[model samples]
Target: MTHRALLAATAIALAGTTAAFADAHTDSPFSITTIEYGERYLASTLIGESVHVADTEIMPGVALAAGTVDEWDDIGEIGDLIVGVDGTLQAVVLDIGGFLGIGERQVAIDWSALRPVYEEDNLEEYFLGLNVTQEQLEAAPELERTDADG
Candidate 1:
């Protein structure tokens, strides 16, 4: 075969192979209607809820001004969240016994013990109630640290 004709045939073969590979990975054939429904339902049910630890109210990433509730003025900000084995929110981890971010400990408070403050039908705030105080929080058990290797 002529050199030009041979080169043209090789080029066509390469193009066909490349097109086939591209077609295989392009898009999925399955429909995502159920996924969309689940996402919307979960978001509506779980989002927009707020949690109050001591005098501070929190909504995930948003942190409001820290204040004192009566004489319990030593409560620190929330550091993490604790979930139960049943996939429900169990407690809020609060940073306590610290001074200027030093010598702090995280302690868990019962989720049910937190007073849910609402506005209209939506959850707007939370209160730890008078039962909890800064002194008690400082004396509470410290959270155990776990390594990622576990």
Candidate 2:
């Protein structure tokens, strides 16, 4: 399949897919409230989560001709998330570069670039994948947010 087609398929598969996390609230603080699966994602838990490079064979104009999707080469980790006023996810600032607290810089990536990898209706063992490369990520501009920006 083409890259766009694969992204569409991934989106369709990921839509409404949820995961159950140990919540701290007695009244289900982060519950999505579905009778079938009852899954919810905690925003706080998403930080520091790793994002890997997804399938590249399907992608056109990419530097790599072939790639192992199963390998899931980690590109970066989530540092912060930008949310719109309407409660929509705008972008995710990823902490790229450096190792063990050395030279990490936050790069804001578009929310659409992330693809959730999971089984049918099962997000228990899923991970976030990106259709980008580590080199690209390293070369991207850093995202600096000021007090007025918020």
Candidate 3:
């Protein structure tokens, strides 16, 4: 009888220990945090990514400025990012126009103007969107960066 009682107490202690371990996991500092799929992107993948412009709005001014109401224009490609002194990304520079590097120039647009759209079927594939018109981009002043060789 003494041996049986000792064995039962041991079993109860073991069960309590298992329960405590499980609870600890739920309250641990190493508990899981989630960054949902498609929410984050690699900078390397964004460089040289094609940027597109489209007339997706129906406001009168927008329609007037947009010219076409339902067309997508491939405007430019991502060139570089402008970072603030405090380390925030403030703007994105794009390489607009040129056939084989003949007439291409860098133009900087505000960071807020960029919109990234990821495909539902493939997260690895995505494109950047800028809501402004193609003409506006073409007319933007060229962004000048000092050359390394200079």
Candidate 4:
């Protein structure tokens, strides 16, 4: 085949490939265009993973914050959840209390609610400010409540 003809064929193939890529991009109806740490990592993947919340000026007691963070704190393994408070992901919840590591507290916050922490050279994990309180956790429905009521 002639060089010009070969080049023309190659250009046509490239155009077709580009169009295919464009089509694929539009086909992704569930594609995540925006980033949401809470929904992407904590809400889905971190359900069974250890959650960590570091001790910092913002979050002095990790347990208090964790208990007050979510409504599902009555069940599950929470020790695996490590929440960094001052490093990067600030205001994140990290519960560290329970029986035989079976009753760890639940801590969760929307990604949009976290305070943006500046990534530092010495920083390790991300931290954020949590909207939690000790009273809220204690007020949670206990496991014995339903049993006792019946």
Candidate 5:
């Protein structure tokens, strides 16, 4: 099947599962209320955390702040998110360069490359340990999502 068809099928499957969950009235541990609470708690703990890049060569978890070329000290923001066919996070599209979206480039880095920082079981930040600088991402290939059959 085509990628677009596959994506649509995945979406439909997820919607059906969500509808079933919504219709469920059981008092099981996996109830919708419990799931919603977990989601809300996670969001409250992780929303404004910073995402940095680490140098694994020096030490295992040594990281540095990541941002645009102009605002090197500022925290990098997630521009978009890419998911796999199984609804798993695959990559994160980040804005690396340019000012106010003028000459910025959207680059997708694999989800595995990022390391989540947690303090006392609450997410506080994230670090990307690809050992590459902002210049590398600026010069790296851009990611484009298209439905056209190749």
Candidate 6:
């Protein structure tokens, strides 16, 4: 019922499913061995898109809202058009910042604040299209962004 509880359930369910799917690994070069999930959010470097750890690593100074939880059932997908969907916590939003390799920052995100993207037909494109900017992300009420002087 609570946000934290929902996140816990989502994490447990995702971990269990991932464990079960682990044995199906193939010898292909693209085969993934392990997919580690974290609790922090990352700001996408590119606007209008979802950020992935595969593309970037977590940055410093960004903090994830730890322990927040949500239900997997409540976690809906943008549709059947995306590569990732069910079993993923709806709260795992990306936190991207900076310019072209300039002051970029990233994080895994709290898995309790995500809202399933409603359009899966173009999930990647849709996520990549998100207009979130570094200033907006840094100024996010949920985040505590400060300069070195702070």
The RMSD of every model to the true structure, in order and in angstroms, is 13.5, 18.1, 10.9, 13.0, 13.9, 20.3
Tens digit of per-residue lDDT, candidate 2, span 120-144? 4443454667876667776889897
Residue 43 C-alpha lDDT in model 5: 35
Please identify which of the two predictions, 3 or 4, would achieve the higher TM-score against the true structure: 3
Q: Rank by lDDT, descending?
A: 3, 2, 5, 1, 4, 6
Candidate achieving higher lDDT, 2 or 6: 2
lDDT of 4 by residue, 1-150 (tens): 999999999999999999999997887677667765523444455444433222333332222333333332323332233335553543334454677656655444444433323233323333344333446444544332246334
Model 4 lowest lDDT segment of ten: 72-81
| C-alpha TM-score for every candidate | 0.43, 0.59, 0.59, 0.30, 0.47, 0.24
Best prediction by lDDT: 3
What's the lDDT for residue 44 in model 6? Answer: 37
True-vs-predicted CA distance for residue 73, candidate 2, Å: 1.9
Q: How much lDDT does candidate 3 score?
A: 0.69
Candidate 6, residues 1-150, lDDT tens digits: the string is: 999999999999999989778855644777555632232223332223443221123232233233211111111112111113564543333434445535544443443333223232332222222223445446655323359413
- lDDT, residue 7, model 6: 100
In candidate 2 the C-alpha lDDT for residue 120 amounts to: 41
Which of the two, 1 or 4, has more lDDT?
A: 1
Q: All candidates' lDDT scores? A: 0.53, 0.67, 0.69, 0.44, 0.54, 0.36
TM-score of 6: 0.24
- Worst 10-residue lDDT window, candidate 6: 68-77
Pairs in steric clash, model 2: none
Model 3, 1-150: lDDT tens digits are 699999999999999999999987787675447744335555677678888786563221111323231246877788887778897888888888897778989898886677665444444445566788777877899987689513
